[model samples]
Target chain A: MLEVFGRRPYLVLLVMALLLAPVPFLQLNDYIVHVLTLFLIFAVFATGWNITLGLLGLKTLGHHAFFAIGAYASALVSHYFGVSPWITMWLGALIAAVAGIIIGFPILRIRSMPHVAIVTLAFAEIVRLVFANLKDITRGELGFWGIPPFNPIGIGDTAIRFGLGNAAGSFALAAVLFVGVHLILLLLLRGRCGLTFLAIRDAEAAAESLGVRLAAWKLFAFGISAAVVGLSGAVYAHYLMILTPTSVAGPEMLISLLAMIIVGGVGRFFGPIYGALLLTATSELLRDFGDYRMLLYGALIIVFVFIAPAGIAGLKPRLGRKPAEATKPVEAV
Target chain B: MSSTQFIELVLNGLITGSIYALVGSGIALVYGTTRVLNFAHGELMMLAGYGVLLFSVTLGWPVLLAALATILLVMLLGAIIQRVTIAPLMKREDWAFNVVAVTIGLSIFLQSAAQLIWGEQFQGVPYFFSGVAVIGDVRMPWQRIAILLVALAVMGLCALVLFRTRLGRIIRATAQDAEAALAVGIPSGLVHTAVFSISAALAGTGAILLSPLVTVSPWMGASYLLKGFAVVILGGLGSFGGAVAAGFLLGLIESFSVSFVSSEWSNVVAFVFLIAVIWVRPEGLFAGRGA
Candidate 1:
């Protein structure tokens, strides 16, 4: 298993998971736990985004749309139909996956990076506008509240309740989802599928010449990535129990995702996860700055690009051989 | 629709299209020369908006002088941003993606800074040409007409400089092949800075003209940036002239759609047209015809 999934990253994942496992039981500060929960959710998001961006070399600027789609779909369905969020979340994921394929089909066909960036960004704008304009359904930018949290699971004489001020269940759910998603990602990247993805990323022409079905693989990457993001979005909806078009679907979300990947280490296995954690903490610290928060984020991106192109993951030379491999230049498509 | 309404929409489309042309061509020029799709192009427009407001409104400068000062200031800023931010990143092997990321950061940074400094209120510039021009059944404001005319003149002058000047030759040569141009002793880096400056100037022009029609605000540039991008893709990725043509086409589509549907859906209609165009011809309408 170590050989298949690569030993070092697996070890890092295990260590991080083990370290974080006892937070809820330890009765840590609720704010700390909340931050951790937010970390896990964003980690899931950045990881899913990493599939298309880092692994597949697709510089998509609009993964936030899928996230919003997932959140809204699950929230709307659960609220309107009186169904449990547990079931609706999966339904949301399915809808987002379909949207992914629909958008990805036209998107992956283009070879120009500028065209791809513009198309994806525009598509996200369309989604945001639709959500904002559909005030009757989404409640628009006024905010969508009263969302039902996850139903508690009865365990013999005890129950794991998930609601406001008690984030233990949400943390647990997020932790499980985070671990499950990473494992799937690891498994996916360890096989022939992984090889095809690498081939396509390194050289599309060469991959196509080698009988790699580019469309199928690209769509697969996009679809799975979108589904994961969507799932996280559903988790977010139930956890936060509130939604706003700008909060979930805005371009700011894209900025956050990009900042995480770029600051952590684009294309690196453990890079974005580390990035998500660091950024979440930094954002909390900058919360007092209010308007200056995004300014600092933008400055952070530029600073990291020039000074620490290899990111935090690169700073750790003890990790393994050739730590800078992920930072290598990808061919501009 | 009535003929007068049709004429009004058409005129509105052309006027808006001219501004879009300026914005898109600026982006196209930079992309053509540098191969970097600047995410902060819109921010430059925003900066110019503030610059004009400061000069004409706060400092009490003449409108023409304020406009000139704003354009030059933005041009200088364009050069500085290229030299400081974009140039250094482009030296790296991961320049393509890094440049995109950095520009996005720069864009957000500028927007936030503007909000912090200028506040969130909308500020307007007085119209440069205030009288109305009546052509039979059509009555158009001279300000709007000036926008269309000035944009045409500016773009025409830009074309002349690009085609007829030595600087234009250097720029064109570099765009064609940077290494070849460098081999022949053309400073490609400097040319890139020049292109960025020119692009900023174009965006600045658009902002100045638009300040009266649309209030100058921090978020004002975001939507135009999106429309400019649609024009870029519809006209061809790096084709300046193509972007100009596509800009007019997009503006027309938008105005006509507003006539049919509500104004809110105009952007959707325009983007749909862009997507359809891309689906049918990924190379865009005027692609492969040279920059």
Candidate 2:
């Protein structure tokens, strides 16, 4: 399985994407389709976070900041400025990438994992507090509602609508963006960019010795990851047509991302995707459990770490592959 | 603006700073000794809050006795957590990120479990000390003053132990070089667990002191946890002394800033200060100091 994935990763992703593409149109409950869409959104988010965290060995616990930045930027711009969600979404990603780079400048200088984690977490808190306090603009936890959805697209005689009334179009849109993001990640990681990240993660000093600009490469990864997270956030905002600072920028968002990557198998290319799918389903199933939902998720994270530190991806037997690589913990500097 | 107000603010800042010191130093101590940033350190404080509530409020134990019992219980919990969750991970060659992740998981689990057991309603504890002390134009509650004095005493005691005790020597040696410590027949793993317990005791103390002022709730630890982390970074990661000083510095910063800015923006100001500090001194302000 590892060999096949290693050799033809795109083929596997394409097959998976193809298999899931029909779900929205399968006439299933709209709620189920909505949940699947959420899974894709989170998968995008987890994958984005993995670039900085898993690949580059940056122990960031604040990727949700980017998500919130994207969501709020897109929502605010589209809702207040009359801009289309389509345009604002990309703009939000750009904004988030810039924020990422700016934050990265200070953060990348710190070598300690705990320091990085604290700094990033503090930054996210700052962001959350700012959004929460900006009552005039964000409405201050009453939640920003009535945000416009993605404008309907017309093709020939048919019109593809968005909003809750039409889940298929939204799911289709999410799927397209999901595949596109993955393809971009695949291309980037399969090339020199991935090698540089690998070098940085595996041996920072060695990579730095070899003339790899550590800060620049890290900023690059951080920026791209932030952009992808922002994009997902933008889509989520438009899909849900509501926004709350806590819902997007809170530590809960960060924990969810962490759970996904950890459960999926950190450092593996498709780990977050599998983790997101499993957790999303689990989350929906545990919805009836109400307050116990997060408790269970938390317990699941610990149990998985204890029982399967390699995550779901690591559960499979990878013949001839380096077991050490699968189990290797993120190096703390 | 007025001298009296300024004095009151300073007193308040110091009182708040004392708690910050407790929380921050706990985090710094754990990180310094174990190199595992315990993300769930706040949960220890949270558990202590619930513990005090259980023993003092529900069971009708005396406040001091309940507080003492809570701290001990939390210390025991810290040891258990370190042994069960962290020790195994640390045995692995690359356990840094895994330990951090596991603590995060543990934090969430503890928080949610607390909510499940206690419900979401905020439960207030009656202040053990009553009455106010009038000094010049400033009036301070005896309870608040007690928080300051007790916190100072607790931290001072911790300092004494860390600097003067045999266990302290063993822990510091392990922190400096685990292999060297092990070669000297020091049980580094046991030291790690001990350090965790000590850290939890500090956080538990903070929780007991804070419960009367702030209502006990499941998510009570979250904000203070962030502030505590900020204090750690500001002080320098793993430097207990630096954490103490930084904690006070942060508390004062927040207290003073709240006067000029809105209360909500004080957090932003405090965190911005942290980021600026990180930018200038990534190794922390006291990076070279030994554990």
Q: Which candidate is the best by lDDT?
A: 2
How many backbone clashes does every candidate have?
Answer: 0, 0
User: On residues A67-126, what C-alpha lDDT tens digit does candidate 1 reach at each position?
Assistant: 999999999999999999999999988998998888887776698888878888888888
CAPRI tier for the interface of model 2: medium
True contacts kept of each: 0.60, 0.78
How does chain A of candidate 1 score by TM-score against the true chain A?
Answer: 0.93
- lDDT (0-100) at residue B119 of candidate 2? 89
Report how far off residue A37 is in candidate 2 (Å).
0.9
